[model samples]
Target chain A: MSASVPTTRLQATADAFLTRFAGIKASLPGDKSLRERAAATVRSKGLPGPREEAWRYTQLRPLTDVTFETPLHADVDAQALLGRLPEIAAPHLVFVDGRFRADLSTASSMVRTGAPSFGSGARPDFDPMVALNTMLAEDGVAISVPHDVDGGTIVLASLATGQNGRAIAFHPRHSVNLADGAKLTLIEIGLGDGVYFHNPVVTVSVAHGASLTHLRLQTESEQAFVLSTVYADVASDGTYDSFQLATGGRLARAEIHATLSGPNAIAHLNAAQLLAGSQHADFTTIVSHDAPNCASRQTVKTVLTGKSRGVFQGKIEVARAAQKTDGYQMNQALLLSPDAEMDSKPQLEIYADDVKCSHGATVGELDAEQLFYLRSRGVPEAEARAMLVRAFLDEALEAITHEAGRAAMETAIAHWWDRQA
Target chain B: MLEIKGLEASIGDKQILRGIDLVVPSGEVHAVMGPNGAGKSTLGYVLSGRAGYEATAGLATFNGADLLDIEPEERAALGLFLAFQYPVELPGVGNANFLRTALNALRRARGEAEMDAPGFLKLARAEMKRLSMPDDMLKRNVNVGFSGGEKKRNEVLQMAILRPKLAILDETDSGLDIDALRIVADGVNALRGPDFSALVITHYQRLLEYIVPDRVHVLVSGRIIRSGGPELALELEANGYAGMVADAA
Candidate 1:
């Protein structure tokens, strides 16, 4: 019945992607069967359209207009690009155009590159974006920590440099595995220049009693588009805490799926999206509690100015056997301009009788009383607006316990505020 | 010095202040005592450049600057302050940050250097101690989760930090106890000198006992009907506003 509606444009884009894969599949460094299986799925299903439940707020029509090509071997100023990164005194792995550049990165023991590490945690068969990434992934980093070891911190920076007015496309596949009782802090930074398409997939597995802290900052070019998918699994007493700040890209989307498969596991999926002008950003998350006594929390905030639009879709599912489950989700948005827009959806599917689950959403502009209060105390209009915006994002920002990561996010927020003013 | 000549203002279609003529000279504090809905708060709002309180016909000047022709921040920079009866609550904005931002903004307008963090913290702590406010007040969000008296004290704390020349206390003593009244009065008095002046607007005469005023004026129906010394407040306090309202009528 659904096939009656025409999805020709989406199908054309999907077919074009499959054609691109067929031309470069042999050159790609990964399992051929994995790529072919993902290609067959794309060949039949096409990219996600507005009809898809999860893609209802986002439309992929913009991708159909531009024909993206492979990145060329253009000269890049590695030092200048490195200067734009946060000043963290730790070893970092730098990837230029989705391929690791040893000369630009500091050597680290836990880091490995040159091939795609498509871990078992991701479901390419379920998510179309993951399938797209699986079909064309080239080079990505794999970071692993042994049992009971503390890996401290590692910064994985992915940069896309598209020169000569050519719109390039790159798919990076990365994974992080923490063994039992292990701990690691992974900071992921995505930045680029010129027009490009960045499609990345990350799969994470946290063993029993382990903890993983993931902080991501995506600030791409104004002419770029980014669609990222992250899948995480946590075992007993394990914790997966992740936060991402999306302030760049013409159109961006960050989709995450976290599963608590063991008792007493914890997951926190939080984000702050700051967009202006005609930009559009979407943040979607799904937390499944498969075991009893597990807890999951989400606090997503969006600040939209100009004619920007922001979307937040969060869902929490508690299985019948997952008794004593505690889940909380909240999405709040502040529209700075009358022309700006926001759409928030919070869902709770609970089959457990003794579970505690709650979800809430709120959309509002800056409080007039708060603004007047600030201005009456001698703060200028622009400065008062910036202050209020920072305050609005403070709730979600406070959940970031990593000092350096928090500082980097704060710097990005200040820069975003500067752009608004 | 602050002067208002034949000031007439309105909110929406309803007129609040009708032809108010007042003067508050330097080195003096004057009390504008009146009952509810007598335009007491309206006068303060008008003089502070608050939005939507339209001054249909009036002229307000502070330190020789046209008060009504500028923004609220400009009025604040020109040494005009309004202590709201209900001080607003600002969540996620620390008291120290708010105070320092306001102070630095006014300082920048006056060609003064910005205050360093330690210096600002020291000054704020000293001012808080003088107001009898707990040290944690500076660390908390501005007026968030504060008691009524504590909010009033925070207002006084802001007044001390900003050090405005002309302050319009709009019923600042509405919800204060005896001790808080004394502390708030002390905060106001500490700023009293030849360079400072205040217009203390209130309904009760008790506040005037602590923050003594040089003169008292009776305002009714958007107009001042009587004027006298500080003893007038005591008279009004003993014999309520009924007599004055009837006499003015």
Candidate 2:
């Protein structure tokens, strides 16, 4: 039935998007020829329809209804914006409405960048959102860490602020390249005010023996929409560890595509979404082991309360040549209310005979025995439930190896819980 | 400190505690001994307010407060503690964290200031040493991988920290070696005082040799058929439950 539904939805919204594309296609950054060509690709493909396997869970009807305008560059007070995430004190870069606010960014001596696209080389056939970002991304940071050094923490804070009641959107293309034997920690915090769409495409390339700890804190405004796309490539013996905390946004989807392109490379993706009210948060991840002896682990946890909905779709693909590949994916959800809902789709596609791959999905309410155990110890019902919920999510956050990043993520989770009460 | 009058309860359609009349005044220890299928565990579950236990007819009171009318948490705030035969294993919850949270919650109910982290850790460490538990147990998940003896000891540790006015140890002696049993009895004996009372429920007389309850009651079916002094435990140990159960029948 959804086969025809996506086509209808796409046709209804294609005109609006095409018109918007025409206005910004010429002005988009990058080589003029590349920008125009990306726009043409977007126009030809149109937006992702509901029938598309990935776009099935997330509908675009509400998004199409909004009269989204191009977000013009507006100078912001970086100090005030920085205060929101005062716990993170590192060399930082600030972006407001997809434009870099230089006055607010701290200079880093290790890495440099030209533009950001959640890079486009991976799978161009499916994600029209990537095409959309490729056609409209204004400016993104280019970063590369030096080899054999402990590159401290780099805070990339994206703030979306707009006025005049204009429903606006911005796409920031961010690219990161870590050289062989290099090490770095990147904390990407996305926060905003007012009604807007913060669609960002990020590309990451990790070289031999290098390690990248990427932490994403998406606390967009309740009225805002966020479609974040991330594409990562890990080389021989490299490790890519990422954790995303999705606690904000009306409709938030974090789509990550990771490829272990070299032997002995590792990709660990962990995410936790604490959603309430009418909010919708979805975490979709696809990890492909294209090299022999590669390992990948993805664990996602979600806590839904009130009338919120949470969706998780995780797929592990082991190629024919990827022998001895070890892949594991688990998605767990805890529903706190009768009205709250969750959808989990865990898939394993393995063509290699010697590979080890497994996937698991579980949805449950608070354990009555655990709750009674806590309550019988004098904790009230609410606090006991909150403790269990936090503990449930903490299990997934344990995948974060970097001490500082893990602590920062824990602090963010605490804040989210505090606001929940 | 504890009182139960005609306490009748059941799980689903099956009746368990037919009619139990028991009371332990301040500064006393009472032991309820019964054979299997005597509703010993059901009594524990009903008193702890575990769901699925229906109290059809009962009147239970703790420190002059009607326990049956209040929630399990409120009963806890009144200093009622139940040491389980099988403790829960909270996978991601640290033992230290659970203890501090429970302690702080009790303190909050009494409008007292919360314990600081360092202060809590210090107290917990001391208690661990007193119970012959390793300090690393604090770092592990709450009873996640703990052995049977370790779980019961952890419960005793919690009871030691919470310092309740009335504690109900339900078959805590089950699956414990003589050494573990001695340590557990010592843990409970340390908490005994003029104000602290406990009802130690067991199926064997071995535990009584160490804890030395002031009174021993033999339960048959769903009723306590006999109650006697500490010497009665030795009598039951020598004669066994076959005689007492046959006499009750």
Best by TM-score: 1
Off by more than 4 A, model 2: A1-6, A76-81, A110-125, A162-164, B239-242
Question: Is model 1 an incorrect, acceptable, medium or high docking prediction?
Answer: medium
Question: Which 10-residue span in candidate 2 chain A carries the lowest summed lDDT?
Answer: A117-126
Point out where model 1 deviates above 4 Å: A1-6, A73-75
Give a tens-digit lDDT track for model 2, residues A15-125: 666677688666655666656666676667777766578877887666766777767656755555567874766788888777887777787776454455444453434
Whole-model alpha-carbon lDDT for candidate 2? 0.85
Local error of candidate 2 at A45, Å? 2.6
lDDT of 2 by residue, B59-159 (tens): 98887888887778888899999999889989889999999999999999989999999999999999999999999999999999999999999999999
Q: Name the lDDT value of residue B71 in candidate 1.
A: 90
**Best model number under DockQ:** 2
Measured against the true two-chain complex, the DockQ scores of the candidates, in the order shown, are 0.79, 0.81
Task: State the displacement of the C-alpha of residue A170, model 1, in Å, after optimal TM-score superposition.
Answer: 0.9
